[model samples]
Target: MPWNWTQAEWPNFHYDRAPLERLEQQFLVASGEILGAVRHVSGEDRERLRIDLLSEEAMRTSAIEGEMLDRSSVQSSLRRHFGLGVDIASARPREQGIAEMMVEVYSGFAEPVTDESLCRWHGMLLSHDRGLDMIGAYRRHDEAMQIVSGRIDRQTVHFEAPPSVRVPAEMRAFIDWFNRTTPDGLSPVPALTRAALGHLWFESIHPFEDGNGRIGRALAEKSLAQNIGQPSLIALAYTIERDRRRYYDLLETHQKTLDVTPWILWFGEAVLEAQQVTLARVAFLIAKAKFYDVHRAHLNPRQAKVVERLFRAGPDGFEGGLSAENYIAITGTSRATTTRDLQDLVERGALTRTGERRHTRYRLPI
Candidate 1:
């Protein structure tokens, strides 16, 4: 019963432009802080952070679509892309497909957007799902596309896309606007605002039969990268996943109104949350680096390898700390040797021991 953004007589957006100036200023300052923190890290640390953050984005974005990917496989796929050493097993085609598409999104953020480019992205995304005949093309059928919930008998339509007949024209207009008014272009609008509006517009069109959400997010990533002057390690989808209820509710509510201030406000907040989260991780990484630097000389090869793996496991370091049995399995050491190795680590103040006997766990002293 409600008119979408494309259906209004004026069909243009209205918002409090003055309030957005503050948001733009905040985003710029945060972006500089993130980039500056990145510059202070070692090149190897920076590379690892890039790979970890991009892999986290790929994994979380896929999870938002109800698809869970093995994080190691995603990391392996990215390593192969960057010519880094990959120690993991070969990834499945589906996992590789997801990772490959995300890698392309990360690496190609500076490239221009076109219908063909979007089609190719869609093709890559669905390559492992759809049949050969259905890849790399827009919807050809005239069926109504509605996002609905609840049972079939009582389904509630949250949104309905434009008819397939008008999809081409709609897509062309959207792409034209996107290319003409880029973040660095003559447009007075801030780049983050453009990213949010573009995301809403793309979702309303729903040009493809699948993967529209992923593509829209990819477009947002490109927009932010363009605005900030480099590809970012902060993953917006991570924050979206954390605030998914609000994310969905805002989109559902705002899509029906020409004034989309609420959605834009939520998007700005989401961007801030993502950067704040990344900033915390950046601090954790710096601490971890200092931790290693302090203990690097005291560690033997086995202890170093185990410490590195645990650190890479994340800030918590191995869910419950690495068990001695698990350590032996990983280090291929005998029980006696593993016991002495762990005790030596504890004695050297590199690790703290918890529990006793078989339940014993060793974690970083910090």
Candidate 2:
């Protein structure tokens, strides 16, 4: 069967916007709520939230493409990009590249979608890689750009993009469509609708030799931020990463037809879910600040160090909860001291204890 891009309708995507009307309004309402919550955050905490969300995005987006980046390295790279002080000497090239691309998407969302801009983002995304026939430019190879699985002898072709000869023209039209459909453009599309369509449209093109998924997601975010008039802090990549199989299935299923109402609806709901996750994260940050304020005086030096470490793990709390051994490793205190500190933290309501004896684990009261 011919791919959606090869259909007669081709770039003229058709979706039932009626179903998405309520979702679009919900997205805008959630966006306003998030902004209001963010405004209540102090400056220091707000900057920290930005770095956390960006780092999470960079890490999650890359992970979706089967690349595992160091969280600290990505965070350090993002901090440096924001002109904040950070020890970024340990950051590798891959982490640095994605971090740079993410910052560009966030800061330059309002810029027109031009080939030069896209290529710049492509360059930054693949700056460290040495293996591709093309780096900053679109794929020019004659062989089919196919997403396949299984062994070479018995591979399954999931999807094949438009041929290389057609990429330049396809992308030119795509860039034009992207700009003209912006909220303030000659033809304004709704925020969620445009973002969902932009992502699906770019992924269908798969213009580049590599990094298409990552860049497509970035484009979606840029669309959202452009409509909302701010850097969209929605955890889109993080949310998608949670149910990756379904995400791919939906994309594959939708790529076969121009009637993409299902895809648009799914994408809209995903963005809404991502927004709620981000709001929870902001609320967590606020709770963290209040937790520190209330417990700071009662925590001893050792307890304070351990508590700080736990809070650094974010809203989920430390993974598997904090064990006594973990406490010793963090504080370098003796077993007796560890026991004393843990009990004191539990007594002061700074931490909640579960299980007993060897199975004991502690988590933040919040």
Candidate 3:
């Protein structure tokens, strides 16, 4: 059931004109100046906090119900990802077996990539305990990647995917083309549009026995990171996940024609939504920082360090239960001093303590 490359059926597409043009302006204004303050994070505790929050945000939306998580889970995943080290190449949600695979991806990276690395990355995404739809379910048999959305009348599709569905020979060639054609080696399209196109192309390829959507989105994310030379502040997929119907329809319409205007509009709108949520997150973080700015004078060095860490890895961040053991590791302070530090912060109305004994965790007071 391989794509004939000659008679593959496609989709027809259209989008409202004025609405997108106006939304595009909103998107520009929304993201404006965000990087200004963010760039101030240079080896300071603030930098540490930004890294923690950014990674936490990225991982949350990568989950099955990633768009939404209760505060506790958000904090927990933050701790898990940061503590274990989730980064660009971390265990992508599609991977399913390895313990600390996310850590591996984060710990390793440099430069934009092409070649067979995508296939390797895609494989790792489906690797141990990441627990995606199809754990390591690459195409071993001659099965085709299919679409099962309601619009298609649940039509059954059958096509041959050779080499590997995740990066079939043809699809891989296209990826190579994309990487090469990027403007002056600086990503051909804006990060936002590139992300959308990455999603569109991969879905069209229908690569992978399972986890196509998840992997495709992840690909978009990585592709975006490459475009910007850093991770983007928003989860475009989260926006798509919010209104999955239009998400599919946009794709369906575009399948018939290659005009990417509607798809670009979809991406632009998603970016704007993502910016809104990210701005809210940053505002909360800034508030937390202001609390510390006012109170930093009363805290000992260790206490200050701990507070900074807490803000950086708020509830959706990576505080690791604020256990004494971790406190000792993070600050190298004595038991009595650490206790006093934690107590001082709590007394100052900066944090709330939960759980007991070895299970204790301290977090920012909402």
Candidate 4:
């Protein structure tokens, strides 16, 4: 559907009042570690959460299904996300951590920030190591790459922008605003509000030729990261990726007037919604962990291997995830046996199907 968009204003966007308050309350409930202070997580505080969730043992063991994440990718993506100049890092670093952090920014409980902070966020997202080398850019710069995602009828764009459309005048001002304004200490407007502003401003400018929407989202996420000082955004993009049609609709609606309120409200609503989803995911994860505790005895060696492989990429996988071929290579098993193992996992509730045939993906169940 040609990357259509829309915008609107709900005045006191039902999101800011109702959804936000509920989200705050729910966050207090989910955090469990700190009820009162969960509303104001700092950078250090955020690292603690990471340490707690992804400790030395946890980092090594944590995986979807029975599969675990490759530490190398994680480290590579982290370095790239931080603008760490790549010396000999792998070509496609693990970006899930950065992606996860971007999702978590949806929660309103973030720290204060400014324009420079925003640009810095963008820099991190489109860092020299991570971003493309575009018009005069050292990183990947060539835009106009068609990275279309979402539904067939209402497909959303992940379009590559033209160099001519690189960061324009007003947009440059906006980035400058973000860099100059956001600071370590400030009367914080809601992070989600700033996220909305950044999203609209970034997209309107169409800064780079490619990855603008994704980068705009990364921009929203960075604003939230600046606000909370925490790097993990729970699931905002997954949410946006899920409801991509409506998101584009709202953008198109708002673009008609160039107003920002409707978009802000929608963005806030998105953050709140992501919180609800992550809360459920956390609960499911804990439940599954408990299941493992009790039923680890019931799982067989191959069954366990199947599960472990799913996280890294089994035969049927997507994104940067592993594939069945990867699984076959890793496990050194025959295709017939591997396919059987994969199908069994899907039936046994160990692996969930993500795609089909050549494009199929499977991972830990939702």
- Candidate that scores best on lDDT: 2
Ranked by TM-score from best down, the candidates are 2, 1, 3, 4
Give per-residue lDDT, candidate 3, residue 242: 70
Error of 2 at 238 (Å): 0.4
Alpha-carbon lDDT, every model: 0.81, 0.93, 0.56, 0.50
The segments of candidate 3 whose C-alpha lies over 4 angstroms from its true place after superposition are 1-32, 40-60, 64-110, 129-138, 149-167, 295-366
Model 1 CA deviation exceeding 4 Å by range = 9-11, 131-133, 300-302, 316-347, 352-366
Worst 10 residues of 2 by lDDT: 83-92
Candidate 2 stretches with Cα past 4 Å from truth are none
Error of 1 at 67 (Å): 0.4
lDDT at 336 for candidate 4? 93
Error of 2 at 47 (Å): 1.0
Give all candidate RMSDs, comma-separated.
Answer: 3.0, 1.2, 9.0, 10.5
Look at candidate 3 and tell me the lDDT of residue 74.
Answer: 34
Sliding window of 10 residues with minimal summed lDDT for model 1: 3-12
Instruction: Give model 3's clash tally.
Output: 30
> What TM-score goes with each of the models?
0.88, 0.97, 0.58, 0.51
Candidate 4 matches the true fold with a TM-score of 0.51
User: Per-residue lDDT for 57-151 in model 4, tens only?
Assistant: 11322221123445555554444444544436463422443333332333332543333443443444334344444422212344453445688
Residues 4-114 of candidate 2 have per-residue lDDT tens digits of: 988998888888878999999999999999999999999999999999999999999999988999999998899999999878356789999999999999999889889
- Tens-digit lDDT track of model 3 for 1-366: 323232343222233455565764575566564555555434454545544444454444455433333433333344455563443433323322112233333333223445445455556544544444544444544444445435566654333333453455656555665575343563365555555666776666665565466556556656655554545555455566677768667776555455677787777777778766666666666676677677868877787787677665644655355777777888998999878878777888877888887788887776
Sliding window of 10 residues with minimal summed lDDT for model 4: 56-65
Q: Which tens-of-lDDT digit does each residue in 1-366 have in candidate 1?
A: 574745564247777777777787888999999999988888888888888888888888777778888888888888888778776577777677767777777788778788888999888778888454457787767678788899999999999888888888888888877877766665635866888888888988888888888888888888888777788668798888877778788888877887888788889878888888888777778888888888899988998889888887776578877898888888898989888889998898888999988888898865
